[model samples]
Target: MAENNDLASGDDILASYHLPSPKPLWLNAVYARHIVRGNFMALSARPPTVDMGEWVAHQVVEHWRMLVTFIRLVHDKDETGHTICNGRTCPKMSAGPNHSFTWLNSRLEPVEIPAYEYLSLVQRYISTKIDDAAVFPNDPTGVSFAPYPGASSSPSSPPNSGGGSGPDWVGRRSGFPQNFLDVCQKIFRQMFRVYAHLYWSHFEDPLYHLGLEKSVNSCFSHFILTATTLDLLGPADLEPMQALVDLWAANGTFPQDSRAYGYANLRAGERLLALAGATTAV
Candidate 1:
């Protein structure tokens, strides 16, 4: 288990800038858990370990720090403004009003939940896959199925010299490595299918429910800034991820368009920073 820091204790971090702490520590934990679980599942090739609790705690801390930094930047601007409520009455506001209890707007208010909820959701998905292992079938036959004699052997061996005591090639060499190409093609297809399923099941559904086009666009901008801080992503990856976020944000696929989008972008920024820190230490 990880050490529990008072969520409210981070007020000092928020004080460094002119922004209010968005919510209590517990709510931050919930958001952190959801973002970490999604990221872990996307990146992990194998099942996660039992030490996930510790990982969750660490992720929550990192996420909180990222949130603080983001709030500071958004409020750091010196632009003041007024809104005409009834088209005749002006409500005065500065760029960084102390009365601003909400983040960006009322629609972007943070949620209150523990981080464990997200961990449970990820575990459930993994468990479902484990229970359905039979869906991923392999060949039962022991036959070599090599395209040519000794082709199934390691690459260290000479190619198709026919020195091995295996089945004879019927005069014509097997169709220009058809079996090798077939296996490669099959593996590629399986990988893509799995990626599509997981992406849709985890990310697409939530985005669709959230109506997040604008938020995602904002995330793209945040990604640029955060990526610079972390130094893990280059222009190639950043550009594409930004484009994807923009597409989704514009399409209104994020939940709670204002809040969800900002929060999600904040989480991504946190992950980038963490990655950079880890890389630097290495």
Candidate 2:
């Protein structure tokens, strides 16, 4: 229901930007700040004691884990009209027909997984009992070792051994079903578009007829500048942020305009500015 409610407004923004909506769960955070926080954490350098590269890699790994969980949930709901794997079900059970495996296998050519044992192994991996080292052990089973688009092929399928060379990174097989990639891409594109719109509306738009707009826009400009300086976004992503700043500058919608909205915008802007400054200082 919340998804449907968001869909109408989200659609309008997407239309303006020539994009589509991503899957609901992907973007429906209680607040935009949550998404921002996740992005920040994903990109930041890990603690001094930890392997920064591996730590960053974990972010992507975690995302995949969540996606798999979501696919399983949808499948169970479709098959039995009840929630699956919500802590009560048998952990070793196979993911049903609605699983992402169906979509992925259809789009990409089928790759060998160790028969019915694949799901059980995956479940164990998810439980964290095996540890990343054990799960990624040299010559790990049931994994497809493919080079990333820009990576060299010499690594020869993720080193098979785990802790010695780091976690073996498995990629989706080249021949995976087309529909699955389409869905994934569609979801990502929608996420980028909707967040861009929300960012503009809340931080770039003017609020009142007075100098309130100008003040709000000024705060937003400072926030953007600080964010850029901190490297929170790369040059490629900075363009939209700049555009938002320019829009606000031209519109003059500051706190003096609509006190409530302008004030809220200012508060968020201040927080973002602080985050940017802190990041840059580090």
Candidate 3:
């Protein structure tokens, strides 16, 4: 877990942000328990190890889930073939030039690209990839599927590779090569910008007006907490929306005060940390 700065205590932090209390996602508690008992208990009971590759794959799938969910909330209108919405639609998040988020390029130099421009790139990327269901079939019995070979990072964002199946823990094992793991990391880093722009720039009007804030905030909180738990996001990557993350975290939506909150899954998956020599505690 990232340490709190000399900033303040939990109470002060929440007050400073003037955020509301977070509701427990307990309405469907029984539903979750049922799934775990039926599907996860046996597997979790056996081993908790997840290596770097599997970890990255897990992050990709989870982050993609959040990204797509939020994207669905957006209304796209384009007179041109391009569906890029400048700050006109989401003024809260519009960047100056082409309305792009500021990011450090591979050379570590700052670069900016419009949000709509990115949507085009990402949509193209997703549409071209072979869908996961087509590649990996569901099995009643657990089965291990190694990552597709020939997977490599694109020299640019919005990878050039036509991808493979979504991340899944094969039967009961976990591990991946460093290069493949890096690909997952890069994918997540870009996808996170998608979340940051939505939460920071356009959570009002349509998003909030449609009563989507609770769902969005809750989902974003989970993403933040999970990313932090796994050390998936560096401080620099998180800096853009760190303040909001801090606010939501303090409000109990994603409590950062306890190790328990830091790693909500540690109890069931301690062996993963053990294998990785990670010290993120429960």
Candidate 4:
């Protein structure tokens, strides 16, 4: 697969993250601009006129696109002229010894697959969702969004608002279908699995090997902050890489006052111990 033109090379990515002075090559112009300006909070904040679900939907699609581009670099050939990432190298879809993911087929039955295949399926699944007009409307201009049929009337869980009372004006916007939140949740969860696998299984090869670690870290940090800000991903979904998240948060990659930072501080020790135990058992 061809990489996105928006993505920069390893040297550029390194320069961007450790900048002596230049835009971060890790992100596209828009994202780089916000992070460079130190205004990711404002960028992550849902606009008053836009529904939270709608805003998240847009971001999820964008993040998926960019991440796919970034990850393709892993497939580049090594000095042996062999693919760096493939089913032979990663026979199971696992983040580590403790967390192995399975694909849900058309029948909704979980089926284990190789990491390479699982990631491919995810890319195709997200691509299909992005192309589905019913899932993500092409032009939602004049079309008013409605609550999904039989949606709960519980004020505790508003369809568009991901259940929170922010500044009086913030969470009240509405225009997205009630199901958008749930749909985006699934999308992001799958994407997070890909990140977990990358961090656990391929961090050394391709990423550190190509000097793309900082670049990938910067992108993942932005993704974590944005996804958590909108509540697209739950804590359980992030458990596999919670340790890395915590480290980034401690280093100020995420603002201390933000929801993302709070999430990063949540229970990572237990998960790490579990992983260690699993390894020891084997």
Candidate 5:
């Protein structure tokens, strides 16, 4: 039957696409920093030495990992539910052709992102900046690698570098000609804007129109919790939704009552901000 064939085709499409999986939520604590007092003389003026680049890369991948997880949670598999704004519904659209949205970056600084430009920019950013070691976006298992108009041919797909968490980076960086961590930070800054736009601009549509409150709230909580635990986000990055978070916590939407997360009774909201305050720099 045609319906059966279509079902099989759908399975094939899903099978060819690859997305990162969420880490066990409890594992976030393992990466949290703690204060350790030492002999004043022995401690020295400088703090402990660390691989700053690689460390930031880990944060980048983890944040992306959670972002992908949340996207999957809220996206309708049938493709009938996800709203295609196509620029008309965007607030910037009403201000004439030259309008732009003020997007927040990794440092919480506001930047001008032009209206209707994000989708293509994101596709280009992911295509060009993604780790050369991982599968290029056009590799059958990617998220529509060549998304921009007139784009043809995928980027060069490099062989696996092995041990990378999510095709962002993993083992061996000496071969790279650029400072890898700086690139990762750039990627994170842009990606954060994407997340902010989703929560800020489209939060209600998904909740009311799509009936995805449970999924949206849960996914966002995970995103906030993970970002907080990793020192990837600062106060300014989260301030816009502080009230929403409080409301969710008060209603028991976060630290979901599921044993799988290992923290059903955890007070996540306050702790999330606390961790950010402890780690984030001004």
Candidate 6:
């Protein structure tokens, strides 16, 4: 778990980012329970002998690999003639008319790009982060993941030891770096964007046509469950697909009390309409 910066008590941190119980998923319940939920429990338990973070890193890496394949399947999907997703058809990286994403260039400035380009960048970004030995250290070889660029110079941030924590462990040191949470959060956020883009833009064509609606629902629902339960994502991050989350909560795919559900301060009605138009089957 990431430590609190303000020297806040453990209870304070818990209250700030609570871990809600996992609700049984309507789609792929068995997989979600056995794979996602089981891993989370193991992490939370923090067994004395096991390197829990390393185990979690492996699971997260595998999940991203699967998610990348799933999204690529949609991108490469064929309908009648042309491909489902392309630069000309999807001009912007957008979940809806309301939510548009911009990419950071080499200079670290946000730049508008085409959807395909944006997703490609996202894939590259995740790959770079995971492969960075500083962030995902190799235990046997002992190279660590990167810390924040100027983490040591900053007074508020904690210092990071450059030691490797094996494959999944963020660090081999006594405490986990706050930067690990930051990196994982960013990764999950980008992944969420892909799911949002697929549901909003390509649901009817490739998703429905290819009969992948349930698969997407199953995967995304499990994704949401895992991400939220572990606090990798927050209410603001989930704003793009708020309506579908609400629908899931109503139907019990997510717990009613889960922080991942029912936090739509943004245009709730518009999102509901978007969800309704996307699919009523869920």
Which candidate has the highest TM-score of all?
Answer: 4
Stronger candidate by lDDT (1 vs 4):
4
Instruction: Flag regions of model 4 displaced more than 4 Å.
Output: 1-39, 75-82, 143-176, 266-282
Q: Specify the poorest-scoring 10-residue window by lDDT in model 3.
A: 28-37
How high is the lDDT of residue 256 in model 2? 29
Q: Estimate each model's TM-score.
A: 0.19, 0.25, 0.52, 0.68, 0.42, 0.64
lDDT of residue 56 for candidate 1: 22
What is candidate 3's local distance difference test score? Answer: 0.43
- What's the best-to-worst order under TM-score? 4, 6, 3, 5, 2, 1
lDDT by residue for model 6 over 47-113, one digit each (tens)? 2333434434655686698688667765654666555677787999987656889998899999989
- The residue-by-residue lDDT of candidate 3 on 1-282, one tens digit each, is 243544444444323433234411211111111111111112111123322234344445655766686675553654564333564554333321223455455798866555665655565554333134322223323333333433222111222222355533221222232244344455656666677666545565456666676666556655655555444566566655544444333333444343224433222122222323433221
Off by over 4 Å in 5: 1-83, 91-115, 134-178, 248-282
Off by over 4 Å in 1: 1-158, 161-177, 200-277, 280-282
**What stretches of model 3 exceed 4 Å from their correct place?**
1-52, 78-84, 87-111, 125-177, 255-282
Ranking by lDDT: 4, 6, 3, 5, 2, 1
lDDT of 2 by residue, 188-219 (tens): 22222223332332222212222243333333
The true-versus-predicted C-alpha distance at residue 99 of model 3, in Å, is: 10
TM-score of 5: 0.42
**TM-score: model 6 vs. ground truth:** 0.64
Per-residue lDDT over 1-282 for candidate 1, one digit per residue giving the tens place of the 0 to 100 score: 011233422233233224334422212212112221112112211112212212222222333333333223222233554211111221221112232111122476644222222222323433343234232122233112234332322121224424466543211122223233222223222222222222222222333245432232233333332322222233323221322222222223332223223323333333333423421110
Q: State each model's CA lDDT, in order.
A: 0.27, 0.29, 0.43, 0.60, 0.38, 0.57
